[model samples]
Target: MAEKKANPALMKPLTPSPELAAVVGSDPLPRPEVVSKVWDYIKKHDLQNPQNKREIIADEKLQPVFGKDRVTMFEMNKHLSRHLHS
Candidate 1:
């Protein structure tokens, strides 16, 4: 078996849009870090729906990035991609 290396593109730091910064801070961060921070914010704010763990209920700070009141966990990454740039 061969060892696999992480993708440089995925490791590269990306800047977040103003809307995203509100939740994840203004510093540039790798995609995974950004996702982690967003998840932290979501957990901290109790944004995940109790009845449906897969759904996220957006707060005011997250509305601009999410573009709606609610989004599924699977769809969050798609929404976040729009706010990140290399």
Candidate 2:
């Protein structure tokens, strides 16, 4: 049996857009780390909607990154993708 290896693409560092940098910093980071940092930022600022855990309430720093004032957890990835590049 062969051991499974991590996906290189997933580990490759990606540059974040300026808007995203406001929350996740300017340093290049992997996708998972970017998502983790975004979550950390959201948690730090208490951006998640209390009425609906699935919704994220965007703050000033996140407005450009998220485009709108609020976004569903599922839509966050789509928005983040627009702000990330290899």
Candidate 3:
């Protein structure tokens, strides 16, 4: 057996755009941490659609990042990608 190591790419720090900063904060973070922070924001703000938990309703702070009023959870990563840079 061989020891497994975390992927360096996954550990790389990325800068967030201003819109993303509104929810996730203005700091360089790893992709996982960024996602975690976004989830925290979503939970804190109760942004998940009641009828469909898979959907997220954008609030004022998230509107610019999502560029739409609603998005599927799967689509969230795409939107977040546009707001992050290595």
Candidate 4:
């Protein structure tokens, strides 16, 4: 039997555009890099609401992607997909 590898399409690095840069930063990054940068921003800015640790407060740049003032961490990955391409 042969083992199957993860889809390369899923693993391919996505180049972030200017719209993404405004949210994540000016750094030119791939999808995984963007995710890490976003997390770093969340941590550094202390954007997670205290009452609900899962809820993140959207900043000026993050607002466009989030489509609201707040979002749950669980929903973050799904939201990210909108900005990424295959």
In model 2, the runs with Cα more than 4 Å from the true position are 1-3
Over 26-61, each residue of candidate 1 has an lDDT whose tens digit, in order, gives: 999999999999999999999999999999999999
State which candidate has the highest lDDT: 1
Q: Give the alpha-carbon lDDT of every model.
A: 0.97, 0.95, 0.95, 0.78
Model 1 residue runs over 4 Å out of place are none
Model 2 residue 28 distance off true place after TM-score fit, in angstroms: 0.5
lDDT of 3 by residue, 1-86 (tens): 99998899988999999999999889999999999999999999999999999999999999999999999999999999999998
Ranking by TM-score: 1, 3, 2, 4
Candidate with top TM-score is: 1
Candidate order, lDDT descending:
1, 2, 3, 4
Better of 2 and 3 by TM-score: 3
lDDT of 2 by residue, 5-86 (tens): 9899999999999999999999999999999999999999999999998999999999999999999999999999999998
Q: In candidate 3, what residue range of length 10 has the lowest lDDT sum?
A: 2-11
Mark the regions of model 4 whose C-alpha exceeds 4 Å error after superposition.
Answer: 1-7, 25-28
RMSD after CA superposition, every candidate = 0.9, 1.2, 1.1, 3.0
TM-score of each: 0.94, 0.93, 0.94, 0.76
